[model samples]
Target chain A: MENVVELTNVTKTFKDFSIKNMDLQVKQGFVTGFIGANGAGKSTTIKMIMNLLRPDAGEVKLFGLDYKTHEKAMKERIGFVYDGNVFFDGLNLKDIKRIVAPAYKQWDDTLFYRYVEQFELPLTKAMKTFSKGMQMKASLAIALSHHAELIIMDEPTAGLDPIFRRELLDLLQELMMDGDRTIFFSTHITTDLDRIADYIAFIQSGELVFNQSIHEVAENYALVKGGLELLDRDTEKAFIHIHRAPTGFEALADNMKAVKSIFGDTVVIERASLEDIMYYMKGGVPHV
Target chain B: MKIIISNSSKEPIYEQITSQIKSAILAGELQEGTAIPSMRKLAKDLKISVITTKRAYEELEKAGFIYSIVGKGSFIAEQNLEVIKEKKLKVIEEQLGAVVTNSREIGLSLNELQQLLKIIYEGEG
Candidate 1:
């Protein structure tokens, strides 16, 4: 399968932090999730892909074309939605429709109108008057209507209600049904990823931790909950991150099969969520 | 098709999907040779990760509750009546064991637990 987005040893440096020596790919026709906590370099990698932030080294390719040499062609097939509103406040929905949508060759007014109706945005209302959710919906509407082959969204569901989030996800799912389009969903919200993401890429302090299929992660990583005494077991100590808790310790293991075999029936082998793996990988304090 | 899922259940999403579909087949809710939704369509309808749904379908195929013929979608596998009966009994034993363990943990006597289980089962019937 072709990768919709590809990065090879990509590196970007800043005064404070940098995305270092990263390589990743977003498979075609799959909803690839980019997950990380704050300052985990998720945004940085996205910006580099968009060419909004120049990478100090390495290459980015979209549609199997060089990102630098074919920047215009690459961007034409791409639609981006950043974390916050990225539209002119003075522009009304009609203005966006009349002016912005014309920038793409595949722009379809019919599709735009469908999204407008589905998202419940008023064509006459200025964007400033719209709620954050409405603003996001508008952006998404434009992104979808443009008929972009690859859509990259950054934290698009950060503050939306559950209903809109579902709506947006459903729309994305629908778009990929034809098996020609792809979506790169960047968010810290693991729950949403749990529902829609096919592949997941985890970033930690500007480095890649894991980039694999969601099924692989869910099936392999397990949240092993046990008492403090269980920590003494050599097998349990080999977990990715071992958190000492008030009552007991919770650890995440990539080799869940091995852990279960070693511990037998004593250790509780509970299914781990995407958040659980990310949390433990970051050395988080156990909340429960 | 009847589908079972728990949003906040401790079980992994895929396993829940796999087991529920298996039970539905065993209960005759999903009949043998009935065409099931493709993994993509099922994921879209359930609003779940596609890979997760695919895994569920894969496991179901492995366990013989369903089988997929390439190019065509998945279908419930026809099983011998004896095998179905055994599978249903195993499911019941697992549920009953969970209830009995919980009852003991909460200090309920065996008789009381039996009465509670009977009441719940009767209500379901």
Candidate 2:
């Protein structure tokens, strides 16, 4: 698979925080979910991808083209939705369309209207009057109308209701039928990724922890529960982090196979959900 | 073909898909050369990531349960039903051999074992 977006050895610095040596790739024709806790630099990485913030060091490439030379060509193929409404609050949907539609050469009015009707977005209503879900739908309708090859969304589902979130996922699934469109979206809502994301790019404190397929994530990470006797220094090497209670100890193991081999039947190993991984990883990955 | 996915299942979604499709093929519900839904379409219908369905199809192809033509989608493979059935029967026989050994170790007679098997098999129905 071709990488639609690539960042190699990227470094971005802020006064309080900095993203160091981040390497990430968004594969074409698949949904890549970008996940991190608040202030985890997900938005900063996304900004670099969108060319909103240039990385202080390293290369950022889209469709194998560098932003330095191919900025226009690259942006032409991408439809983006930011976490907050980028549209004018006073402007109505029709007016917003008029402003945004001209930016894309391939913008199709028919397709745009089709999405408008499908999403039931009111064209005459002011952006501020629309609910959060409606605003997301409006944004999505615009993002999808331009026949973009890559769709980038930053926290598109952040404030959306469950029903609308599911609708958005279904819509994305339908769009993926084209077999060429790539989607990279950042979200703290891990449940949304379970249905649509093929790859998960997890970031922590501005560092890329892992970019792995959903299957790889499932196979590699697990939650293990066992008696405190299993917590000796030698045996503890199998776990990424361990939580100890009087009754037992629960731990997150990055290597499921190692955990299984080490503890055998003495411990119970269960599948770790994305949320579990994120929660445990917040303690920070120990350099074992 | 209808496939039901249980999010809570210990079995992975791809395994569920493969097992269901395999059963359909073995049960003759899916005939040889019958075209199956494309992986993308299946993923859409199942409300799952395309990678999951892709993995399922790849496993199906590898197991000789199906074959894919470039751009033409996948079709049920030509099945040797007799051979498949014979192979399965051999597995059952091996398992039954173990059961017999365990039963004898427990001082269970052949007649008692036959009665137990009959009851268990009929109970499933």
Candidate 3:
């Protein structure tokens, strides 16, 4: 498996916040979901990948090529969608295409028109007049028209309704049939990832926490519930975070095997969803 | 071939897929050398991530229930039916032995156990 996007020890600093020593890899030919809370440096990391913001320290490469020498070549193969509309507000879809289409050598007018018809987007209406979902569809139509091998999206599902969100996931799955395309999208909506994401890259407060396959996550992390009597200095080592209630105690365990061995059948271990992992992680990563 | 997935089931999606396909092979529904849908195609049709279908197919291959070529898709593997049947029968015998011990401990007669087994077998059909 090749890595389409790679960041090695990347450091970017701002006046108020900084992403420190972040090492991330987006594997080729799969959907890798970028997940974190708002203001968790997801957008900052994406900007670095897009070469809009340069990392202060480390290397950022796309398709094994550095942006310094291959900016034009790399961006040509990468399609991007930002959280907010990056298009001109006054321009209609046709005018937007006219300005954007000339930049890509592989842009296909027929494919663009086909996506326009399939999405039922109004080509004549101003982009500002279109609804949120329509704007997303318009952006997607353009991103997909150029035969891009890598698609990087930041919060692509932020303000859409549930029905359209599902439709968007289905469309992404359809695009993945090609077997050459790679999708890396950041979203707070974990349900969307559950449906289609192969790998999950979870960031926390400007730090890269873990990048693992969804199956690896399922096998490792779990929510364990048991009596408070199970909590001791020795036994508490199994949990990343513990929440106690009058009835019982619920804790997030990073190692399911260790939890099972330490507690045996005394505790009930359940699969932890992505949201649950994120929520429990707010308590802070445990010291090794 | 049709595959029905239950999201609410405790079993993981890939295990569900592997077990269903395994049963299909054992029941002779999918014959030897029958071409199966590609993992990506199956993933798209089932509305699941491609990795899940890939894992299921990999498991099937590991268990000798299927095989795949580099460019070609997966196919049902040549099965040694006698060996598989014997393996399954051995498992059944072990389960039945446990059931007999439990029934005897509860003072149930062999005739009562036979009648119960007949009822369950017919009802399942």
Candidate 4:
């Protein structure tokens, strides 16, 4: 299978938190959601993929084209939407489009007009006068109108109402129906990914925790609930993360058969959700 | 679906899903060709794990209550009406037995328990 985006042993560091030894791939024609907690380095990894930040080690490739070797050509075909406003506040919707459209070789004015009308964005209003949701819609309209084959969205739906959130997801779904376009969606909202993402890649503190098909991720891990005795130091060590409750406890284990064997009758293994997996990866911390 | 499950009920989550789905099929609430929620969606709705929902689905398939066509999805299995009726009655009786056992522990006569059940069923409890 062709990979639209590939990261091998990618690493990035900050003064407080650093993501190390990471690797991931976003396959062609699929929506691969990059999931993580607030400080799990999701944005950091996305930056590396977009080549905004140089990785301390490893390489990122787009359509088998190396980022360093084909930076200009690669970027033209890629639409990047940062988590916040990347356009100037003083720039009106039309002004922003005017500036961005000329940068892409395949920019389509008809497509741009279609998106603007569909999103119901105010073309004459400055970006600062638009609501956050409207600004995001404008950003997306600009991104999608360029005929870009690959789109990298960073928390594009973070502050949108549920209605608009669904709208954006629907747009992406429509885009991917072509079977040639790919979307790299980075968000803390797992529920957004739950609907349309074909694959999910989880990043943690800069490290690539796991990357796999959504079906595989949903099927592999289970929540084992039992008495505290089930989490004997040795057995607890066998699981990824453990959460203690007053009556009993819950833990995520990849190998259910092994966990069952170790704590037969004492532990009941239930299925784990992607949200649960995210929570577990965050050291059982509650989702804020 | 003619199904019963309780978060506080002693029955497991998988049993709740399977038994309800089975009852729905047998009671004609869910038709033979009716599509069921995928394991993942069911889990999300119930806020449980996919594993538990999958187990319920697997058990349903094992009991010949449903079958899944890969990539196409899962549906209720077609069965003879008589066989479906029998399975439904058997499960109903099993539940009635458990209710009777608990009713007896409360020092209620069969007549009184039946009255109480009537009230409960009528939403007068």
Superposed by TM-score, candidate 2 places the C-alpha of residue A139 at a distance from the truth, in angstroms, of 0.7
Candidate 1's error at A170, in angstroms? Answer: 3.0
TM-score of chain A for the candidates in order shown: 0.93, 0.98, 0.99, 0.93
Q: How would the candidate models be sorted by TM-score, starting from the highest?
A: 2, 3, 1, 4
The residue-by-residue lDDT of candidate 2 on A64-145, one tens digit each, is: 9998898999999999998888899999999999999999899999999999999999999999999889888888999999
Better of 2 and 4 by DockQ: 2
Report lDDT (CA) for all predictions. Answer: 0.84, 0.94, 0.95, 0.79
Alpha-carbon TM-score of each model against the true structure = 0.81, 0.97, 0.96, 0.69
Write one digit per residue (lDDT tens) for candidate 2, span B50-108: 99999999999999999999999999999999999999999999999999999999999
Interface DockQ of each model: 0.52, 0.85, 0.81, 0.06
Clashing pairs in 2: none
> Candidate 1: where is the Cα deviation over 4 Å?
A232-236, A283-288, B8-11, B19-34, B61-125
lDDT of 4 at B56: 86
Deviation in angstroms for A177 in model 1?
2.8
Looking at candidate 1 chain A, the ten consecutive residues that score lowest on lDDT are: A279-288
**What does candidate 4's lDDT look like per residue over A179-216, in tens digits?**
57888888888888766776788876667777877656
* lDDT tens per residue, model 3, A9-55: 99999999999999999998899999999999999999999999999
User: Per DockQ, what order, best first?
Assistant: 2, 3, 1, 4
Prediction 3 TM-score vs. true: 0.96
- C-alpha lDDT (0 to 100) for residue A82 of candidate 4: 83
Report the error of model 4 at residue B12, Å: 18
* Candidate with the larger TM-score of 2 and 4: 2
